[model samples]
Target: MTDDRCFRIDEMDLDELRDRTRDQTLIDAFSNWIRNFAPHVDEVIAEISAAFANNKLRDGIGLFEATGLDDYASDEELRRLRASDEKLDWKRISTADLSRCYCSPSFFDPQGFVFHLPAFLIAELNDEHPYGFIDRIYRTEEHPEGWRALLTNKQRVAIIAVLELIREHPDYQHELDDIDASLERFRGAQSMG
Candidate 1:
């Protein structure tokens, strides 16, 4: 692979993220967002795990019910992924794993949803992928709290950039209204928080 193809998202700083996300394809932009938030995976997993540890409610996505897992993952991989006690190693996660994980966004906890969002965005952006899960991002029943709270400022901006790109793409013109509404909500939420 070439250097750009081999680039690791965790190694990028804010300026690199900004530069990379600008004028990129949707999948590339989503990859940048994944890289931007890659460093936080472990901490996010820890926080969510701690917050829900004592509660009766389950936290994060269950490996068994995740559609991607059922369709693409092996039983051994599922066994390994089910261990939430270990920190999430986003880099080690395969595209098939991402595909599986992304298929079950509705089952993810609000805070934990960030864990698999990059995958969902990537699958949506990539025409090669079989499934479509982008609609879940804006559906009230799936992410009722809105995406603003789940992202850091940079991450939010990156997403907005992707949404904007989607708006301009002819194939995705139908999503324009939802994209506009989400952008408005994100911008408004940013100002309030």
Candidate 2:
């Protein structure tokens, strides 16, 4: 005997279904990320903070200040930002703002295997905010860091970037057309767990 019960899949708006799914996947991805990162974030921030205090996190990369690109900076204004001797002071935000919040242009490894993360971002991770955070690389490595998680480093970057683009320039077109396929990847991982 078989009993069939029909029910709604979700209360989400169909038009925004993909976006909602993508956000859910990223949020889920954060579950394990926060576990590993929560304890270390503070230590990382302390190191970076100490460096800043010592005037070590100085100078911009090329023409870009250590601040990287500002969320509010328009494309034309960004184009004007280039490498030069004139250093732009690091754009420092309060711990509350960075905690459980997303920050752009973050590097994974600043001093070899060591990293400096903003205290604010670390706070958010410890709190496990719904939207989560972004990981920026100040420098690239020839090898992978080997994070054996559902989302790879690049995947996390793409997902976070898409969300940021949606937040910063909702009207602008982006190259995130294949998000559904990516969502399936996350969905698969979730089911396994």
Candidate 3:
């Protein structure tokens, strides 16, 4: 009789053969293989978005309130002051985790993901910073996979509200071109003041 141990490959069930060999090591190996082949591009996109959002908030406020001029000032002077405030300091804030101050599922990715931004960072960005601040985080985009920002749409609107307030402030003014520059100037002014 033929030896049962030396079974023919064609006689085995492919599904059963695959299932019998599965384990943590195999799973890990597959994950590593996939990661190596398809590195996380979403990470880079999220980082860029984070930097952009942070800068936007900082500069928007700075430009709106840089002139040191108030309601009593002339329109031309207000325009110039706004232009000056448009410069901001992009590097002044760090991307720390801030999950404690405010908790909302909106900040989570629709696909179910996680991220953290420190409350101190948010406070510093919106409260302590010159010009004005956004007390909440803003989420700009989402992916089908799993990735999330510390901010959400509602939070972004809240920030925009603060920006609008800064714009309407008797001493405030806003300009588009000077937005980036204003953040830089404000960072410097904040450091000095």
Which stretches in model 1 have alpha-carbon errors above 4 Å? 1-59, 62-81, 84-86, 140-147
Task: Give the least accurate 10-residue stretch of model 3, judged by summed lDDT.
Answer: 1-10
**Poorly placed runs, candidate 3 (over 4 Å):** 1-70, 87-89, 92-193
Reference-based lDDT, each prediction: 0.50, 0.32, 0.32
Better of 2 and 3 by lDDT: 2
Clashes of 3: 24
- Stretches of candidate 2 off by over 4 Å are 1-48, 55-76, 79-91, 95-103, 106-116, 119-121, 125-193
The residue-by-residue lDDT of candidate 2 on 22-46, one tens digit each, is 6664444333333443334445445
Cα error of candidate 1 at position 73, Å: 16
> Sorted by TM-score, highest first, which candidate order results?
1, 2, 3
State the lDDT at 26 in candidate 3: 46
Worst 10 residues of 2 by lDDT: 1-10
